[model samples]
Target chain A: MTDADLSRFSINQETVKQWSLPELVEGCGKAGVARVGLWRAPVQEYGVERAARLVREAGLTVTSLCRGGFLTASEPGARAAALDDNRAAIDEAAALATPTLVLVSGGLPAGDRDLRGARERVADALAELAPYARERGVRLAIEPLHPMFASDRCVVSTLGQALDLAERFPVEEVGVVVDTYHVWWDDTAAARIARAGAAGPGGGRIAAFQLADWVTPLPAGVLLGRGQLGDGSVDLRRFRELVDAAGYDGPVEVEIFNEGLWARDGAEVLAEVVERYAAHAL
Target chain B: MTDADLSRFSINQETVKQWSLPELVEGCGKAGVARVGLWRAPVQEYGVERAARLVREAGLTVTSLCRGGFLTASEPGARAAALDDNRAAIDEAAALATPTLVLVSGGLPAGDRDLRGARERVADALAELAPYARERGVRLAIEPLHPMFASDRCVVSTLGQALDLAERFPVEEVGVVVDTYHVWWDDTAAARIARAGAAGPGGGRIAAFQLADWVTPLPAGVLLGRGQLGDGSVDLRRFRELVDAAGYDGPVEVEIFNEGLWARDGAEVLAEVVERYAAHAL
Candidate 1:
């Protein structure tokens, strides 16, 4: 227990998706875990202000808000609505006092095959939003989902591409999430993570670091195939080391999206997450 | 039908996995298809000499052999066994008078996570086998599987990585396979194809061009999720143009692994493949 400092450990609510905001906050507080990463739906459902006060009262930190960007909509009306939604998300993050708002760049627009066009639109949307994020003291964290999701989820499929987009804005206003499950397969990830931290304007640039393993025979549809730590092929500890080497001293959020994990009790899942994080991600 | 010449079209038998060697050759001959790509097991089962004679008698061109490399085995005994297998595949290609042998670099060694190590060994194996392939008048084509297969199936995940490895050997001895199903999501694929053909010591060095579309709700295992032509997101026509622009005028082989397509009658599947190839791949 001498080196078991869980200060930087956090649980993303999606890992225990069935848990309510209040229960999650109370659970983390009781477990001596200091931080929780929240999703937009539950917070809005529970009332963002109440959720914020609940966590504030429980002395639990809000590591990050689930998402804010789907800015690749091609239709003018839909695109405008996405931006408006992102604005609201940023405001919610501000209300929750979370320093980072995760952004999953929208996939290709329906009936649209232009991936490059979609990625470019994400950059343009960021330019519009970075000032807002900066004004609120929140960094927009662009999450680079795996290439498997390139067509349907997030077009920012590599850490190098995420940094390419993140660099266009100030480091303080925008940054990248080095989620183990997403960027693990990337050959250049270690170097890119290093560059993300060192090459940014003032250094210390990684906004959020997440942990999720990758297991094969990916479940049908593949979205819920994220493996629990130590259950798959990814060298999770190495990723932790890489981010640490890049001088990123921040919350390492556990973010699994597997059906099996989601089927379990929240406290039980949180206990195993902490154990695996210490063993596989430390 | 004036412009519907299929002189450069070939169907890998796995596209009709239910068909036998003699039946496949006869089916291609019946369909007015001149070229056919082949797999190792069925060829061996039918006897290489017999299969070669059968295709030759049927006036069918053997474009390429299915595969010859799984050189990432770390155990000395297993590694030696894989090489022996690949060497035999090359000898079979030579006997069949096939112009190319496709290579699928194996996945990570069992219980091992060093992907870079496995990839480097693929290079080592290629260096050993390239001269043997060249001496047999057969070129080895490195097929880069999609990034999704980076862990459990194939470590060579992108066209760029394939070209990087193939360029280390002579152009005639080694070349790259441009498979749309495997590489459609890659952002730099078009550029990589151009480099593959134009930058080799010998110009126009692409050894094989494979076509398969991508579909969603990928089945349980995800391996058999390849869509039928004109059935998914990939712009197969644009890929054909990219390969054409790269100066590849060789056989455009249709190699799909799908449950639904495999369940249909082989002749019916072949007919539909021809129609779809003309529409989506021309």
Candidate 2:
């Protein structure tokens, strides 16, 4: 494959959530994928040092860490704990040599109606974590989830809102992650991607481009029904074209959260993901 | 009951979806609700003249028509047919004496990825029909649905987006319908309501205020499943206060679409609805 193809692909670990860290690395490497996005739980389970070694041994790049946010809750202690955990996550991402760490700003604090205040707290947490992330040469990528998740998942529910947060933080350390599954339905996506892309490298703009498809009859809890490439309604090629037009030439990471995909053999899923990505997203 | 109290409540026909039009009218009268919203199918089934006479006989007011939008489609012929039907719906709303005709901007055209264009088509249709509605003394109220319906239902999914459309037409002829179930989760709801309120009576803002509770574990094909007041997580009183703060003292129409509620006896549902409105909404 050409170097251009290598620069345009990455695999978010969620696409094969059932696999162990080493198995995921081996599978992705064999599939000709250059980069893998790691989720914190898996990294922690395998131990960060071992996970880092496995990734290195497999010659696979760690594109970005899956998460480091949920810094909002009624209890001050829980919020503080999230921040502490996020700091460790930043350290782990740095160790893995991942340049970006994604953050899904948590939902409304239980028993509270202060959405605006929760958003402020997210900004504050990002501000506090920015310096450490920058010192480690890692960038924070804020992901704006779909509005359906506004209540219990992420309060930052629009591309514009995520961009606002990115703009408020230090550009050297903070950026935005554009996931098609979440923001594809947004009317302002094209314009927002263009604006983010114009911000340039390390300028706190589009740090990662994650892919998944939109499907109907969202499952219970409304969080785990994400479709694999070509399995649902979203046109990933058009989305890729839009991001490319906006000057974002980053790796297109596949991040499905479907139970069916999760239950399959890791290698089989990885192979299908690579084939689907090339067919529907490239 | 005092005149002010009577004036503060409206019943959306869907609250008693299991009831026939005459039964709904009788129940509204028995409950002493001043106004009622009607769905097109019920109006068509009962015949417009009979429905109007029932409302007049019951001493109940027709607050707004339940719906008259879904103009977007794959074929031009289908769109034209929808527009023709909308015209007939406007005539029926006029015959029923409802002052406002609600619109649910339809979803993406089949095989079409242009959401922005679908939205523009909705605006264009509204513009085309505004004069007809104005002539019939029926104001058009664009109801912004929740984003979950962005794919198969309405494209106008936020108050801001609805207001943007409202701005495209003459304010006196077109306005926004603020449904709590749809817009309650929006982050900018308060600000949008404030903006709507600031645009005075003739400015076509806050033409209707709908109430319903949001419930989780939303059942599949969730076209129905609204929660009863105080039954879910939505803080109805807060929303009522917000709209009131925005200078909207209009009827708080209860528009529940729950299958569970629909199965109960019509009068029983109406009685519960009235109690919930008083205890939870006000």
Candidate 3:
């Protein structure tokens, strides 16, 4: 396939986690993949400026930064620390020249059963950081993880809920991430995708569109079990069509976290992803 | 606590799976828990009639039968077999004198991506079984398993979706199950619980209410990670209050499937469940 065929394609760093920052840039450059989604840890490890320069010089675009939210911490000191860390993440995303900072809103605090309250804390955190992110020319993308992670990873478990929170702020400053693996199960996702795509006062609420398949017999912890494209039940093309209909023209980032994918050669995995995106997600 | 305190409490058989029919009946009798929810497999293995007689002799009530759905088969032979098996389950539920039969609507057929099609098949199966269930004096309670199981265990992954399916039939013929473990993470659960509790054309649509806590680091397979009451993030007492407010005075069944709980002495587990229920779920 020509590069034009994969124009919107972006490789999320976690999908080929075995590759270092330099290897990732080199790999994507060789594969004709123009975009990459970087995780904060690896970027921080490589020195954000150095990693940014590496991708920039290699003619690769940073589509989005991995994450910046864990705002469910309610204790005074912990809340401050979370917000501070998120600010740092936004700075890193800005330095990397990425437009989006993906946020997995944290889950309930220890022994806390107040899901609504935890979610409110997320909204509060967003209010505190939205301005900082806006000033940095970075948009914060709220990602509603699958409901299974509601208790431990993110209380935002549906696209509708993410929209609810995102609508409270300017669409340019705050938006939602539609990760197929997380929302493909919900019947309301299509409508919500449309809503996020629809132009609001600021712009489209849709910031980042991610792709990962949902395979069965989820591995332990359920965190690293994301299936490779075409390996699970999600209809990736339908999601792409829905997002396209909703007016989103951003990078389509493949972000699988399967152990099996990680053990393979990074370039080989990237090649297969390119082929699979053409086969299953075009 | 007095027997009056646990008057609404029901021990789901799977909670103490190590116990046989006789042990379960005796344990419930001694523990002052007057009702028990049962699984079809163990009941059939123990002989439905004999098991029914044993519970009757022990003066214990059978609150509900474990399951009767998986109605997502597409092939004609498999669909017919699924209907026949559900009819058999209805017969067993009737024999056991339980008014409710929990249904876990099956996931998508293997290699299929049409989730809406799979869901429609569940509706068709319900239509086929509803009349039979009504005639047998059993209500098919559609249990929306957690979204994590959307691809393998159940496609109805939200209370709202379950109600949409259940509302299609006469409330007496079909209803929705509000299992806290599966729905606690949902922001709309409280409102949906009210809808399920509201008096519709055929009375309240809530056929059964089950309880299990949401624990972390979900085990491999993610099926048996249900935590003991009060050991996880669910607001159990709030769920009870919501169900109660919705005018559902039916049994509040505690169903857990943790390996730790299963490995413990059945009596000790039962006793601990009673105490935890009193402390957290009452």
Candidate 4:
């Protein structure tokens, strides 16, 4: 890795899902970002093999896959299918040469009042996939979403919660994706980051660092409107400093999902993301 | 307290601010609610003495005063005014015989980056007001708003955070107000409630237990839109059970601030609140 590699950043494709894979690659290349994180739906839409080749051919690194872990369903058969899908996602991440596969722990099983039990199912699902991912040289990055999404999205809602789950597997095979949008509001964010950096109860692992700004008065269905870097209240420089302090020198990927950004030209969005990463992040 | 007391829930005035004080009182009385939480602005607007008399004449308990604490400003003049206003609010709470004066710890001071500094300022401000409140026989309940409001509204964002602040003052003078809307998503909510109940850290010191539903797709300016019980995702019964387990047998106040509820007749809103509290919150 060169000096360029040290400052490497990626534009998560969700930031411009409206664009095609080739267009995203061209835009990221023009923006001087050496990497990009892709979502599975778009990969499937473009054909996984072709998508992987396009990323490689564009001379861009596929930093990580956007997701793969909704393994908490009411039926065992559905859960099994999700695991199978995740196994396939892991293979895709490996083929794309990305080192980590982001895992979004799914929500409550129907008719189940036990949130903790649902969380346990996520762990069981991860454990089943850990060996296969490790064999393929891909790490699982459990991304704990905002607590607001605890019901219908992710039961794991804190970095500490994700770290606790990650403790069940080997550090190299299982770590966490620290997304600022989801965890910035947490009182124990710094402590949890430090813990994730340390030799975990599971293993010393800090696999990925994802970034997005925190905006106030979060609009409903908050899965969208992720503010562009430096556009919202979160202090990205401080976040970068915290991540550096945590002893993790991983890629700082910009993973925003804003309607405003999406509506713009993909190249323009990528260019703005790169400039913000340079100006606002260390 | 009669078995009737068990059915007596309070509607925070903000829940039906569109209603006049006398109208709210009449509505609460009609709904069989034992109490109502009043705000300083509304009390002042309605005439404090007249509001108190109306509440009394209507046979309603002033469960608490809605607020009095933005003591984390950078200017001494503003801080002094906050203190003076809090003192006046205490007098009003005393006039209504309301037991608790709710305190919302203000956000970071202008030009100040230290969250800990702002928190300390809140503690100092509380210390200054504790004696006056004790003399008035009014308890100050520090209400920790959710962390999304940490920068602009309140720095105190967790029950544990509020409890830590409460420990700085005497148990009789200062305590925490646990609102389900603010703390329902906390990972350690049950443990924190149990800890608050353990009295002085080890056992029962929760000063107030307030109820509201946690609705999803939270709208902008999230200070509003608190769901009525059972209308949203929160498990009010679990909360009640936790508080009961923590040894708090206080009145379970029903506080909803939904636009839908607000547009309805105050009496109908109050009636629905009581019905929901009984059916869903126990």
TM-score of each: 0.96, 0.92, 0.98, 0.92
The TM-score between candidate 3 and the true structure equals 0.98
By DockQ, the better pick of 1 and 3 is 3
Give the CAPRI rating of model 1. Answer: medium
Which lDDT value does model 3 have at B109? 93
- The DockQ value obtained for model 3 is 0.90
Which lDDT tens digits does candidate 4 get at residues B1-282?
113335446778888867988788776666566678888898999898998888888878888887889878868898899899889988988988888899998876654545667888999999999999999999899998876677678889889889888987778899888888888777798998887887754235676778988766667666675788887767888988998888887667777778888788777667666667778777
Query: Largest TM-score belongs to which candidate?
Result: 3
- Backbone clash pairs for candidate 4 read B197-B203, B197-B204, B198-B203, B198-B204, B199-B203, B199-B204
* CAPRI class of candidate 4: acceptable
| Residue A56 shift from truth in candidate 2, angstroms | 0.9
Can you give the lDDT of residue A39 in candidate 3?
A: 97
* Residue runs of model 1 more than 4 Å from their true location after superposition: A1-3, A201-205, B1-3, B201-205
- For candidate 1, lDDT tens digit of each residue in B227-254? 8998887889999998888777789999
Kept native contacts, fraction for each prediction: 0.60, 0.26, 0.87, 0.27
On DockQ, the stronger of 1 and 2 is 1
Q: What is the DockQ for all candidates, taken in turn?
A: 0.71, 0.45, 0.90, 0.43
* Positional deviation of residue B210's Cα in model 3 after best superposition, in angstroms: 0.6
Model 3 error, position B103 (Å): 0.7
**Whose lDDT is greatest here?**
3
TM accuracy, model 4:
0.92
lDDT of 3 by residue, B1-282 (tens): 344488888999999999999999988887888999999999999999999999998889999998999999999999999999999999999999999999999998999999899999999999999998888899999999999999998999999999999888877788889999999999999999899888554228888889999999899999999999998999999998898888888899999998899999998999999998889888
In terms of lDDT, model 1 sits at 0.88
**Two-way lDDT contest, 1 vs 2, winner:** 1
